[model samples]
Target chain A: MYTSIAGSVARPSEVRLQSPRPSIPPSTAQPEPVGSAFADLTVCRHSVTMSDPRAAIVPAPAAARATDVAIELLAEMGQDFAGSRSIGETLRRALHRIVDHLDAAGGALFLLEDDGRTLLCTASVGATNIEGIRVPVDRGIVGRSVRSGRGELVGDVRTDPEFFQAVDERTGFVTRSILSAPMSVRDERLGAIELVNKRGEDPHFTPEDLRILEAMAASAALAIVNARLAAALVEQERVRRELELAAEIQRSLLPTPPRAGFPVVGINVPADVVSGDFYDFFELADGRILFNLGDVAGKGMNAALLMAKTASLFRCLGKTVHRPGALLARIDAEIAETATRGMFVTMVAGILNPATGEICFANAGHEPPLLHRDNGTFQAFPADHPPLGIAEGSADTPLPEATVHLDGGTFYVVSDGVTEGLTVGGAPLGVEGLQDILREAGRLPPAERLTAVTSVLTAGPRPLHDDATVLAVVGGSAVTRPRSGSAAGRREPASEELVRVSVPSCADRLRLLRQVVALSATQSGCCQEAADELVLAVDEACQNIIRHAYHGDPTGQIELSVHHQGRDLIVLLRDYAPPVDVSRIKPRDLGDLRPGGLGTHLIRALTNRAEFLPTPPGGGTLLKLVKRIR
Target chain B: MNTGMTHRVERRQTGMVVVALEGDVDLQSSPEARRVLLDAVAHGGAVVVDLSKVGYIDSSGIASLVEALQKARQGGSRLVLAAVSDAAMRVLQLARLDRVFVIHPSLEAAITGDR
Candidate 1:
């Protein structure tokens, strides 16, 4: 028996000596004793009872007192784990408090590392600091407790085979008895808590001590799990923010919107934070627009990185390499040297000559480019070579280059994502669907037409599985005059003189000449379209006289006359300037994409027969242009 | 709008320059048109020439626009023709310049540079 501050009570160890199974008297069970409330909280494996009813009169029985201490210790440890932000610091403090409460020589808390095969000592309170000690999970008493998912109570370490001696030998700590309890939440085994050598007369830990330690281990396991989950969430958020910034930067590298009359336009939509598809177009110094569209084999970061590399390489080298095939070959070689195996790029590169309305292009394992003609016909040019990076410099064979005249037509180049894109019905939008969309929006401007087509695919419920991109080049309308049987083909009864006027050879007089021709042609039974053509033709003819014959001199004189003969209108202009070689007055080649030389072409295009008339007088040049009324 | 004698130059709050020509653009008036267009291009901002009120445009007028465009391109600036009249459009189409020069349907569209 021991004497407590409240009253005399049987010591916990001495009570165990009294009987194997004790019984509580009826009187003791009826009265509520002070500090005995914790008796119910203690998880008792064996039923505890008072031997005598008289002994229960005391404030607390030996077993009840021991239960109170255990409940208090567990409550304090729970508060420590819950309130502390630094779990490491809180755990170390917990181990220290537990050691003091149990009167143990030392204790250590081990946690399972990510590898799951090793136990790392994370917190310790003992003669030796084993805070960074590592041991295999199958090595010692601690490992055994964790592996078995149970608590271990060692009465004497020298006799126990599970006790590992290397740790004590290294730290110089004399370990006698040991208590190890595994930390677990449900079926998940975290690690184990180990206490060595009881400090009092009893050098071994009691079964009650093992139960208390196991309860503390459970709380620590839950706290560590929560901390790890929080860390993972924070890391995920950071990666999301980084990806958003990368997408914005990728957008900045793309070309700006072209000027209103610019011939080429493009659009790109990515399925994720970054895109594997890219397109670019820029005007070369020679007035031809160079353009390209590429698709990497995959999606996400690796593909996006390759997309950037390929796009930039095209833009940088395209400025100098004029041929589409040669440019693709160069890019292919560059990419093949560094690109990952099994990954490749499908690309279509082209150059558009706005002046001649010609497009020269090369396709490398890409979707065929569609040419929608003004006369309601369609033409497609398929790939002539394999995709880049598949075979080094795959475009070695002279690619089958195609030149198409865009006579009031449009050329469309798109990534496979456009054709393979899902529609509202969850089916792949085949080439036919894309063509239908294009025909529906054919009359719209080129940019709006592309938008209309892309919107149909993008408007579906599902996200795009691949990157979608489009590039369009709209052709100019070809000049076509009304034929003989058309609405402007009305015939007059007789030929008549339309107008006769003369003025100084000056640019200012050209407009007056245009008005004269417009009035005369209208009066001579010409339709509004034919009259407009006559006005422009005469205007251009007179301007040529002022610019070439007069040499921009305002002193020279010019005579303009318009005559109508049945279905024919003839315009005559005589400039009083020194006439020279008539054979040298030829218009420039129309293929030349330059300004100024177009005036001569414009006159010839508007008239059926434009020729230099036989030198009329002593020192003047006479030019006549004939236009059929139809 | 038929005056053929007046032109207005406006600098909007968006830092865009607008040169509005209200008349026929021909050999006689083209020199003045060229001066206004070039000066706007030299200002180092996007320039939009509104030709909605132009009744007619001759080759000389087209030449002046081409010269301004060349100068704008040399300066790394932008120049676009907006609201071109039908008569002028026909002339440009005849010259095959309708595909060369950037043409917008509205002055606002030209200034915004969306297309």
Candidate 2:
């Protein structure tokens, strides 16, 4: 009995413990009274329990005092685990504490694997020779306990059918009288713990040994659960990193709002990593543009994926040929073949010809759109077919083309989310309401109109119920007149004020002249576009001065001036030379880009009066060219 | 019409267009320069609007010029500035208009230089 309790001797001398040994004759040590409390000696510090050595021996008087001692040891180990950051190492130390503090021969800790299939033996104690040994659920006693979820004590190993003798062969030890218990947590069987043999024994494990094994298994299970949860957290972090990377790639694909050139202007906003809503414009052959605005019926990365697919499909179609209605019908068929089978899109595909200001669109079950006219009126056009993918040959329900003329007027298309968008209060800005805002802003410049849309959306600051998208196009008459300044007919200076600026060549002279003329139109102070004819006349005269007078070498400096008479701007020019010989002057020789003759005629054609005089005491000539702006 | 605070913008054809100033032209009236510049090109014979009496020209003044430049580009016209008041000049120089405009020593000089 004495040698068996220490564990080291019994593992080797498993059968030898059958000989009853009276160690320290019972009389020498006073017979201690039985325990006052039969409760297991396993103690708990802050609800953390420990192994009880005297669990099988339930004499009341003796157990109470032993329980006190076991609890004290458990409290110390609890403090150690709390301070440890390393979960695996902490569990290892915890298992070792159970073996050292309790009278167990050995113990093993098993954790549930992520796949939930295997019980991993991570930490062990009293395992001197074999530490790396893993017991599969199909292998040994440990496996059976987990499968049955019941503790098993084989009093004699040789006679027990549940005993798997291979471990003994591997460890070079003869194990006997085993006590083991299953570690269970919320219906999940983690693993089992086994104490090989009792130390002080009549060669068999007692209920006390089994009780201690159960307690140790419980502690191991808790630690394993915590570690498993931590592993799951790290996996989620990895998934998040992948999502962020994908989001960045997709965001770069969207085009920025271009400076609305001749005819068109549009805007788009994705709801998430990918948008179910998308708009695209790609140039096709012969000044024909392929364009589309589509809405996928879903959310998140899935919808974004669908949107990308839809966009690429159209791009492919555009590459082969440019047909509006037929292409949309093909796309509808394609959508049915590919993409999420049940999902669909409401799309409008078209071809735009800026030179002719014509757009042929196939509207396939999208929101009804509004076209703003140049006469300050609006027209709403609705859908004909069901959304694409839901119906085949549905585009055959031909939507009569609402061909409205576009001349410096805007057209707006929106998803239901846009018009249905409400204030923090319950006021939903519906089609008419939205039309009101657009109409009010219709008179505004194109840039301001776009800004107004942003402001309108921002009105709903937080918790937007759904995604909103606004696409606006201004067609034809994209030529916006100068609103801030007018260059009607600004003339040259009457009193002859002119600043000399170096010109590089005749080509540069025209450009520089344009620059100076533009600057004068803006800064020359009277009123913008003050005098239409005079400014045109002065510009023609200046061109004449550059072409005919200087031959446009672009090397010399050209002077500028703005002379006025009671709000009128008249221009004058002077050069250090003689007056022009009026009769000999001929028109331009276009053969090699020379000037003078044509320029003077053009000057005569544009200006009110023209004259030339000799420069004061110099070889240069002083020329006068005048026009009125105010 | 209340020409308000005048700004004598210079010209490419002539030297400067004298725009007279008579009111408290602040941020509200600053873009008026753009309006005035555009109007002057169309009507301003060849003269600079004088801003010597303008009490204050703030950041809005910079904005006004930028607006004027945009308008000129759209209309294919010329725009310039002649004389800036000392206070306005200090503000303008700080804002770098001295680097942007013709910025003559005086309005008359701007005109004479053009001649």
Candidate 3:
């Protein structure tokens, strides 16, 4: 019987149940028009019930013979499945045994694909090789059996309207009768087994044969389901290992941590198996450190892939581009060309000269990179342009660059993840929270400081919803702590011009301006106490402009410029409000004890001279305050 | 920007509402300082402005203290400043309010009414 089976069909030594049917050519099989009630139609008319006592007592010799064949088929299938792990081989051997026992001309075993949309011929025996052919789940008698979860029997195929003749046209096999039984375990309809043209004098399949086949299909379905589960678990493990390898590769792509006290350092905390946020800093031959921090728009593999592309592009092009604004423009053009739709990166790229304490950078719609002066105040540089990939091509105009002389200050560039990350109180650690963290962490070394600041969101009990990244660049120049009266350890400004900035004449913006003045005074070789005095004087001057000149109009503009010359640091404040009479702007008597008059007195006391300079061309007042460094 | 690193208001068991100021209390933060000071003064009780952590204070801050002191005077409440840093002290003395308002060398001294 085994030799006959080998001759019938060229079955492989090992059968993979779900292997792709690449060997089989596309069949010219046409679909059959099956009536909605085709499942109700059966060839088993005049069926004898073995459960009836009369039928069992007067059982025909043929019934006894059929019972013996059923036993042999079941026993053979049990051994065939238990001995072989190859599902296709077990199924093929079982199909052959069913054909041999039922005296059929041919047989085919069809199983539903994973999608359950098509029935694929997994095994075939005798006459025509229909193995690897796929029929839609809505076509043929096998489809009806599987969909309806019932056995189908057609006594005469030529007259049966539900009979599918396309297989015969292609394979040239004549079929007289068909018996197909659904292979199912409980509610799960696995597939179906179909036998064609019983080779006997009767020439038709009987109800008894259908019942025996249904029982056999049940056992085959259970075995097939188990094999499928085992295969799926193996596939899942393979994918898991591949992801771990990919994560390792991603980690290796990041630059190594700098030495403990290195001015520039970064940290990244990923939310998932991978991160979409990235930061990089490298030193150029000119003794300048180039650094960048970026966050891709989305999460997971696509964002990770884009992060790699953007990070590597920055490292490669950044060396040659030199200028941060132009380099970011080039990166934006490159990313816009191939980036996935609806995805963009918010990034800030900058270069810092540790010796000069000068930083030149461009913000690309990222969070405002914070500049923390040693005075315990913050100056945040907001993005002047849209993020990368949103602006399609390189701009004809040079991208705007923000240059700051971080004299004894630390500049921080961070992704929004750090700002948006939840704190221990389950609220977002906003910019204010970051400021508080930096105020304390600023004293630590660069690498340790990044860790200490980021740990607020990373080490908390609540999970991070997004990736958090931070990059810090500490300035080289040193300044005396505020109120340290003597100029013991202070550095002079590198050049005469300290800082010139224009801001809206609003109360909210005065803090940054005050910090600028304070930094300028300290940079001009004043002690911390003198710097504080200068900051106080400038804050009073700006408050006077906002309250008396602008009349508390928040829309008015104020342009302030500080310059260092001789022994004095000069502050020039230009406001859009109409000029005020210098003589009439006298401080009110100190005994008045009013909120409106103290700003004026403080200005005169802190500076050596407070006078309105010549009005600018724009019909606005220019107030200059000179405080000689003592 | 007010990270509670700058200023905080707390009630002491000695019936004094101490407003602790830190970092820079200039034009930007003086209004908040004034609000906290005025709120303490509005209680019509003894109020102490803690300047131990204050690095710098402009006239705007001094104005808040003066206005709060005037309100305390109108309400017949005790108002004093504690731990005034030299920078703040200079601003107060420049305005000559140092001679007007009672001042303390330490917070404990102020809480104990030790001047």
Regions of candidate 3 where Cα sits further than 4 Å from its true position:
A1-90, A113-118, A132-140, A158-161, A200-208, A395-398, A424-426, A440-449, A452-463, A476-630, B1-76, B80-86, B90-115
**Looking at candidate 3, what is the lDDT of residue A494?**
34
Docking class of 2: incorrect
Sort order, lDDT high to low = 3, 1, 2
lDDT of 2 by residue, B9-105 (tens): 4345453355554343433354576577566656524444455565544444445654555465456654455566665665455333466555666
iRMSD for each candidate structure, in the order shown: 3.7, 18.9, 2.2
A470-570, model 2: which lDDT tens digit per residue?
66666532222111232332222223343445343233234344445545644656344333333434444555555456665455444555554433344
Task: Give the winner by TM-score: 1 or 2.
Answer: 1
Query: Which parts of model 2 are misplaced by more than 4 Å?
Result: A1-222, A260-262, A392-402, A443-451, A454-462, A479-630, B1-115
DockQ for each candidate?
Answer: 0.22, 0.02, 0.38
Predicted structure with the largest lDDT when compared to the true one: 3
Q: What is the lDDT of residue A628 in candidate 2?
A: 33
lDDT of 3 by residue, A1-630 (tens): 434444543222112112333323334111112210111111111122333443344546687556545644454465455455688988998898898888899999998998989998999998999999888888777898999998888988878776777888889888888999998777888899999998878988987788778767766776677668777988888877876776776677677977534578788988877888888888899778889999999998888889889999999998888889998999999899989899999899999877667899999999999998644459999998999998686633446998997755689998888999988888899999898777545535567667876788977788899999898888632211121233432222333777999999887787788778878888789998778877887888888889889998989999999987666677889998877766556555666767658766667666655556567797999887766686
DockQ of candidate 1 against the true complex: 0.22
TM-score of 1: 0.55
